[model samples]
Target: MTETFTVTVEPLEREVECRADQPILDACLRAGVWLPHACTHGTCGTCKVEVLDGDVEHNDASDFALMEFERNEGKTLTCVATPTSDVIIEADVEVEEGVVHHPVQDFAGRLVSIEDVARQTRRLVIDLDREMAFNPGQYVTIEVPGTDATRTYSMANPPSEPGRIELQIRRTPGGLATDGWIFKDLGAGETLRLSGPYGRFFLREARTAPAILIGGGTGLAPLKSIVRHVLEGGLAHRLYLYQGARMQADLYDVDFFRGLEADHPEQFTYRPCLSDEEWDGPHGLVTDVVDADFPTCRKHMAYLCGPPPMVEAALKTLMRKRLFPRDIYREDFFDASDKATGGVRSPLLKA
Candidate 1:
């Protein structure tokens, strides 16, 4: 027999049944309730909540954003906590309503092509028989055939067009999905299963401030989609794209971004930086470049997508320069292989 428990979530008075082994956040997701979360593995503190009344069993998720005092007061990270009995919890979590869009049609798609963009990064284009509508910055979970493993990748393609999606994947040594399947032996016409257009990392149309986009390595995947959408929409806000790589070889699609900047000189600027390269162009870390160029970030809206280290560094730099956390958006790309190889470390969790 499967163990089940009832969970009452306050502020919305929503109740849902959760399996004894399932995390509260996963239950909420299945129940069609949206919650603010990043790095679902007990880090980033985006899913912290207070337990008003209930008996629950959960491992310490100090890394998930809960202070010791809060944890002592019955606070828990919903993504890692499992209820032992009927429970009531209170949170200020934002729940997205309506059906979520996905890039794969009904969780199935065929890999139509894979193009090498760099030495370690490749762009995989998958074609689906049916349309998969998704916001540009949202990502999908791909399950490679013949394995129980899965990996999440942001769709480089925009939602305005459907029936196909593009993903830029970075190969990690010993990564089962990235190194084993995607990078080594995966080929065209292969079938892959996918789910979700999940993530709250998409660009917000409400802000009209001059925008700053920061991306590192393959994190440029979603940033590219946002820039394309902004350019295509012809939004009048001034936009600047700052992409950082260790060397010039890691930077891809320079001509595409250059064309965008040329077409909209008054509204767009593209700056590619090589942190450790011998180039005469912009040098040093990407956030450092942002700091030197724009000292006051108060009037700017920033969208950051990248590795945890770069994201944390950029966040600190932005906050120090007067940009509000609410005005900044980010997507933390978690390495799924860490779960398998025990090598993935989240900076947010450490904080």
Candidate 2:
């Protein structure tokens, strides 16, 4: 039997019950205490906190993400560190308005359908046992069948369409979640244990600035959710969505987004760019297209999701175009490989 302990959080002075084997961040979130977190697997270091007292076992946190020196200095990555005793820790609690906090919970999902949506990409439609309430740009962690591993994916559908989930997955050769399961033995009608509403990269409805959305590869998933939420609710702000792919064959949901643009010309703009192979339709990176379309973004907000390189480049481009760091949101789609070679992360960035 796993022994439970009370973990005390500073500043707020909140307490949450956590099992000996559970991560502190997991306990905090489930208790409705939204501490800062990203990558949830200890690679990104966004959930780093200071252990003001008590001890913990740092469970699979990468040395690069939680430096040895930092560990010696009483800092721990709350996402991967499990409490050994009653603990007191200090974590950054970001308060952003118009963002609804949803407590994380587990759900039993049945895979209703799966099909190829693009080159090396598949679209999965899952029906959950019950409805889940999440923000427009949040994600879920899916447990890989026949293994103890799990993979995280952003939802492509909006919260309004609860009880059903649309997931866009990009196949990675020999990858655990991709090759070993999803693209391999997984099939329709299969049941999966998954959890949600993780991540903080959702749309900020309180902000009045028109938004610029940039996505690459399967990064388009969460962005799709945001698009639907805004358009369906008839938000007044304009939206410019740019999706970058390797080529025409690599892109998906063309006609769908085009239909959206046709219906909402004044409020919606869609641009799909191809980088590798092009045959006459916005040839270049998506960020390059955004750079060409907008001369400046002084009073606009931007949401970027994709590979780290693309996100980094877009950050530079947006900042160069006069968008402040606070006005931009990013969610880097990291994988197991990224967990191996941990990359640089910022406290200001929302996952």
Candidate 3:
């Protein structure tokens, strides 16, 4: 028997139905209602909402995402909360005008090919059944065929074109998806299930403030999308991109970024940093470069995407440089395999 529930969103007077065993966010997506969310696994606080009415069951979620006070105040992460009955929830759903348009899509995709972008990263190109409308910085969850495991990867393709989706994936040691493919090999024409166009990490057009983008490893994936959007839209504001890797070879798309700087001679700047390499472009951690360049981050809007440690460290440095916490936007990339295999702990969860 299928159970049905109702969700009433405040101020907007919008109501949606929730099906049994489905997350509230998933139900919203099915009903064409877009909500801010990242890492649908109850990590990022983007999908947080106030449960104004009814009872709901949620899986174990990170306290950092929804604190004890917030929870006591009837707040919950909509991504992992399943409605037990009729429910009413309130969230901020206003999409800023002129920003990228993102919609949920259920499209069939076939893996066309995979090319090694670097020793640790591979670029996967997927051909979808139809064009998926998504902003450059949005992400999709790829469900491993015949398994319950799914991994979220950012779309590196430009929003202007959508039929094909591109993903930059880093091979996590002992990761089921990466490890299995590494040794067994996967051929073309393998079908995989995908859903989304999720995330609010896309560029905001109204803000003409000077911008700084920081990325690490595969975190560069979404930043690449935003840069392409900015260039294509002809936004003339100054833009600085800093990408850091362990060594020279780890800087996968240095040429691609350099091309952007060359094309928009006056508008863009590119700095590639190596954390532990002999050669020099920019040395030390990526955050150190930001601190050196922008001593006083008074009017800059910063976008950071990367591993948790990098994101945390950069946040501290940005704060120290006088950057307002609200002016900084970030998407922390969590490796599912690393968490599952005990390789690394999610700092967000740790906090």
Number of colliding residue pairs in model 3: 0
Angstrom error of the Cα, residue 25, model 2: value is 1.1
lDDT of 2 at 45: 81
True lDDT of residue 251, candidate 1: 91
lDDT of each: 0.79, 0.90, 0.80
Kindly report which residue stretches of model 2 are placed more than 4 angstroms away from their true locations once superposed: 344-351
* Clashes per model (N, Cα, C within 3 A): 0, 0, 0
Give per-residue lDDT, candidate 1, residue 198. 66
Q: Quote the lDDT for 265 in model 3.
A: 82
TM-score top scorer: 2
**Per-residue accuracy of model 2 over 36-118 as CA lDDT, tens digit each:** 88688888888988899999999989887888999999999988899999999988787786677999999999999999999
For candidate 1, report its TM-score: 0.83
Q: Give the distance in Å from residue 1's predicted Cα in candidate 1 to where it truly belongs.
A: 7.9
TM-score of each: 0.83, 0.97, 0.90
Model 1: per-residue Cα lDDT over 229-257, one tens digit each? 88887756678999989998899988989
Evaluated with lDDT, which candidate comes out highest? 2
What is the C-alpha lDDT profile of model 3 across 88-144, one tens digit per residue?
Answer: 888878766677555576888888988888877888889999989887678998786
* Candidate 2 residue 200 C-alpha distance from true site, Å: 0.6
lDDT of 1 at 296: 95
